[model samples]
Target: MYCYPPHPVRGHPCDNISGNYGTWQANAIQREVVVVGGGAAGLSAARTLIRNGVKNIALLEAQDYLGGRVKTHRQDGILTEDGAEWIHGGSANRLYGLARRMGVLSPRVPDSSYAWSAKTETGRNADPAGYDAAETLYEICERNSVLSQYSDFGYGKCYADKFSGEYRRNRGRRSERAAWLHFLEMWVNKDTGLDDWRDQSARDADHFTDWGLDQWDQWRAGYDALVAHLKKDIPAGTISMSSPVCKIFWDQGDKGQVLVVTQSGVSYLADHALITASVGHLKERQDSLFEPALPRAYRDALAVTELGLADKVQLGWRSSWWGEPHYNLNIIFTNDIQGEKSWLKGIMEFLTIHNQSNMLQAFVPGEYARKMEALPEETVKRHLLSFLADVTGKSIPEPSFFRRTQWQKNVWMRGSYNSYVTVEGGNTIMRSRQPLAQAVEKNGKPVLLWAGEHTHTTRYGTVDGAMDTGEREAYKIIDYMDATFG
Candidate 1:
């Protein structure tokens, strides 16, 4: 089970404890709280607030739908996820726990086969012995806490300089070396959502806590079920869909209420406001989103943190092409000289969707993912079919249906997820995850608080992290209300 560290509630110096605390009034109409963005964090925050007797709250979602990065699509009676597909951890994961309760949790089969490709020809099978040696090296790194020891280097640097040497010595074959390196590259890219592992902070990557499970688990019924579960307790009329917040007006005067204005000129005033926008969106609009502007510290944090793109292409065929697969095919394109700079580089892996015989989903990450999102639908489909045929060494048929996720182009979510980047001679990770609690009033009242996956140090870039931040901010607000308004 995953354990959360205790987050201390910050002292609100702006709250007037002595005289007429609860009766203090401002010019604008008052609300208990206003939550911006209706993703996992926002929904969780709203739920937490309502459960704790904070009813006078407003939740705003820019999109018509509730789930942010956890979108699910159904085509031709087949359910496939457009966003997050797996629960990274075991029972300790909050989303996993929710899935179990909802009876949507399913054990993801640990079945994968890799194929190697050279400049001239593609191999039918990958070097199993070489792959095992690479796995052994990875195990050694994990067991000895190699990344923690080498905090100065990035994941790519550490692997290339240290671990790669060990693997090369064990394997010794040039073909095997290329295959292993390509596999590692694909693995790290998919895991971190970064274009290259060199961009990933080794220390930050090692800091994540997991359930010690090797295999991944999925929500069979789709992530929308989990979103619906979260929304179950939230009161109706509290959530306002399609209400994009334009600007947040705060820090007006002593005891002044925070004003949240929508794009359509509708405004709501609240004692406190929680900004649950994605780090990508925050990075793009932080300067203009706030009326008084954000603090330098917050801006610096945003600058240091990294948001990456990850996209999925789901193809549904009329019939299953690969006859009763003994094991799942995980195609890794190694040296495709013909299509090095195209969508082929971004094609990390293709897997047959669990329980869906005729469906295949391609995992695309990094800069290539953004590029894939820009290409024409037919262009992507044609390239994917040609690439798959080359890797499998068989003629592949066209899919009846095709769907791709455009997270990079999504206005609400400029990128798929967040990852920490190394900043020289400073605590960049902590700064990046630090809650935005700048005192908006003389009495130490924080009118603005930030929550999202990016705001979590250990669990950033996951649904669990988003939910945790939401609950954490909600508790902080609850504590502040109890202390000040009680």
Candidate 2:
């Protein structure tokens, strides 16, 4: 998807290039391996392959820039993350470990009661206990014991069946308890990126190994820093940006060569090909992109899995009107029905950007994410500023910087978050992604390999998960080369 520019950065030059190992210019393009996608997984694979002595590599990136969903934009001198915001898990997270090495894993600002305030859409202070009460039910829903029975149904079913009762028992207002529950659902919806949580597989939800709190740490410097780190080991000329793959002929020629065709009409032939495109792109392009068509197993996996949509918006001010520097304004709308084009209702919360007191950011979930993107930038800004004014009773000033992301609308990406097991899929989360992870062999040689967060069983929907998949596939190629070519 995204990658470092083909041209070298001044400090990081691409030199000592080593390649052309395959016969007949490696069947034309002279590549022993062709990596299709330059996101974390693709870049990791390229670096690992080069380190392991397979230097005849060509990495094709669809986007002009690197970091696929890990993009960041400059907002009044602050790095506003458009995709990945936090470093999930603790020391167990590989990215977290990298951050530790980079000396950037340390928290920038402390999170506390002073950091957050809750309010309803009517500009009234929502009861803090209502949120706590919702959180109590949320923790219950997270428990394995709660959703075990609904394994075949959904995590939504468990919440639907029990949340209202929990609300009533916790002394929540009967008239407005439903609104609070909706707020809780929206918060959780951003987790999996589903408008209807009922579509999520309850049984498979717990398959992911919980390292710790999903946001145990974050990159206040911006996630692009990590992308820069991943590409340091790769040779300069190895990456080719503005190269979106069109067709993949995996089992090609007598020697089992793989031919990768890009939209630019350039074809790269290699002994092996590693594809790390997002599942959203794959699901959208699978039928047309793969030659000889994907196998029944992969097709089934793609068909059943869900890659959802999420959007982000950031606003930065030269001066501050908001009281607290780290204020997290949590909005819970009591309105049961959504107004026409009322996508602003989809915003779960707006928090002061970490370490950037002049900035605030918000995330939109599900269909509303797409809807928000369709509106004019000015329209979106007006609604947001008006709402903040109404809630806080302060005249809001124009932001010095304002930006929003359209992850759902990007053709190369198709969605924001990673894939998940669907209740309708009738397979475990692992079972769904496992088939796609397997290499497609020709005459016992790996001709095609898959790597992405979607291909990871336990670590899907994480940056480390994506990098791990890339490393996993790179080793598969390494082992194959050692056994065959060596």
Q: Give the range where candidate 1 is weakest over 10 consecutive residues by summed lDDT.
A: 12-21
Instruction: Give a tens-digit lDDT track for model 1, residues 198-257.
Output: 776666666666554465788887878878988999988899898787667776556756
lDDT digits (tens) for residues 1-486 of candidate 2? 112123322321112222322332344586899999998889889989999999989999989998887887874467878887787767777878788889777574555634677888767887676677767766777776776778788667777788778777778777667777777777777777787778778776756666655355787577888999989999889999987886777767789888787665567888999999988877777755777887776676677776877788888888667867777888888774366448877776888877777788888888888888888888888888887887777789998888888887787887887577777664443334577698888889888899988888778888888989999999999999888768
Candidate 1, superposed: residue stretches over 4 Å from native? 1-29, 112-124, 137-144, 169-172, 325-327, 332-341, 423-432, 435-442
lDDT for every model? 0.70, 0.77
Candidate 2 residue pairs in backbone clash: 3-66, 25-30
By TM-score, who's the top model here? 2
- Each prediction's Cα RMSD? 7.9, 6.8
Error of 2 at 9 (Å): 36
Clashing residue pairs in candidate 1 (N, C-alpha, C atoms within 3 angstroms): 13-443, 13-444, 14-443, 14-444, 14-445, 15-443
Model 2's TM-score against the true structure: 0.91
lDDT at position 30, candidate 2 = 61
TM-score of model 1 vs. true structure: 0.87
